[model samples]
Target: MSQPRATAIGFTAVLLWALLALFTVGSAPVPPLQLNAMCFALGGTLGLIWAVATGQLSALRKVPLPAFALGTIGLFGYHALYFAALRNAPPAQAGLIAYLWPLLIVLFSGLLPGESLRPGHLFGGLAGFAGAALIIVGGGTGFAPEHLTGYALALACALTWSGYSVLSRRFGTVPTVAVALFCVVTALFSSLLHLMLEETVAPQGLLGWAAVLGLGLGPVGLAFYTWDIGVKRGDIQMLGVASYAAPLFSTLILVLVGIAEPTLRLALATVLITGGAGLAARASLRRKPTVAVSASSDG
Candidate 1:
């Protein structure tokens, strides 16, 4: 796929993720790990079927073991740390810290080969972070020293995801189909954790079941495959900046569905996140990619 097309495809993941909060709310009664297990199981199963139908099943055999390990760990570890963080601290505070991945992705992309860190990228990243922070912390929740453990875990969650995303570039040769296996393994891990940690609570109704299906098909399933293409071949810096829109869009979705009330804060966040993304997009469009040492060539 062309770089532009791949980037567009990747942005769809962000759009899909906007529905995460809404779906999770609708999927009530089900615990987080159980929900994760069900969604990923559905996603992975559908992905495998798609692979078979498209004759991509054979291609999966060529993927390196390290890629599988990385993908599974990235997916599973992130949620584990996030759930732990929320348990140790306030949700608002812990979530704010965890949302640092987008900024981290932009910063970390500077170290990637053939990617230049522009002033616009840095400024845009900060702007986006500020906007996201405003939305997350707008409830007047303050961090307490008592929550240090949760805060640390939340930071680790950010590092795990950002590191996973940036390092994914090095494995550009890995087929996106491999994400199906990753999701499957992640589902197994989640199922084990759910069984060990919490009692099973099935979805409450049709709405809950539908929400789980939606999450599986969109956010948890196709999003990973498209994101693989974007991070590996598209403008990583731009996508990093653009990711800030997820939370903002999520809020808007909530408001549209009558789950959240609109506020001045939301309007301001709209400007900052969109403006930051636009600035980064302009810089990405103006600058040309240069020949540099490939990340895969490094030890």
Candidate 2:
């Protein structure tokens, strides 16, 4: 397919994957390592399939090893910290904090030349954080001591995500299939760790096993592959923008399941988040003006 069309679809795929991730949180209560192992095991299979189908498996070894290693380490770090934070903090709060990854990305992006935040980004970041705060504070639970600890870990998750984003950029031009292969390899290694350290592989019967595989094949693997494709197709900006929808979807799921309830404060927080995100997205959509005029730009 043409690049533009591929990019547009890729953004949609990202939204789907993010949504799947939100739902996958409470689907099964297994240990995070076991969950990662299962999901990644599935990811390896799926990634291998795509690689073979695309006839790119032969070139897979040629992908820069350092970049792949960084990506792998980034993945491992984010998930481990995230699982640890979940031990202490409510998942909703922890998840919300983790969602700040985009903001983290924006902050880090400034360090790199040729990438600067625009007015839209400022507005979006504010709005996104506002939404996150709503999701964190308004989720009908008071903050516990563990919550604070978890929040710290959540911040680490954000940083790890930023690291992955940077690492992935090194292979930004690489095909999504290749990236998927690297992720699959990372998943395989993580799964092996699960076997060696934990004596894991919970025997929760078929349904439990299904959840594990779903975590891996569906959200972890399939969704990620689509996302990689989106990145390679040059829709990272759009994909990034749309990804702000993640916490909102996740929050709604929790609320619907009675895990969280809505309050006036929560409502207000949602408004701020929505308003800010809307403003930011609109701002980002505006065209950049010529260098002749930098004194002011409404967007």
Best by lDDT: 1
User: Per-residue lDDT for 8 in model 1?
Assistant: 89
Q: Candidate 2 — worst ten consecutive residues by lDDT sum? A: 290-299
- For 150-197, candidate 1 gives per-residue lDDT tens digits of 999999999999999999989987777888888999999999999999
- Candidate 2 vs. true structure, TM-score: 0.79
Model 2 lDDT tens row, 1-299: 44445446555554555446454554456656767766776777887787787677776777777766766777677788888778778877787778777676655655543445676766667676776677665545765674799989988898887667644655655656665665666677767767776755463667666656666766677766666555444324444545666656656666777876766765666676567656655654573532221111100
| Number of the top-ranking candidate, with TM-score as the measure | 1
TM-score of each: 0.95, 0.79
How far does residue 1 in candidate 2 sit from its true spot (Å)? 7.4
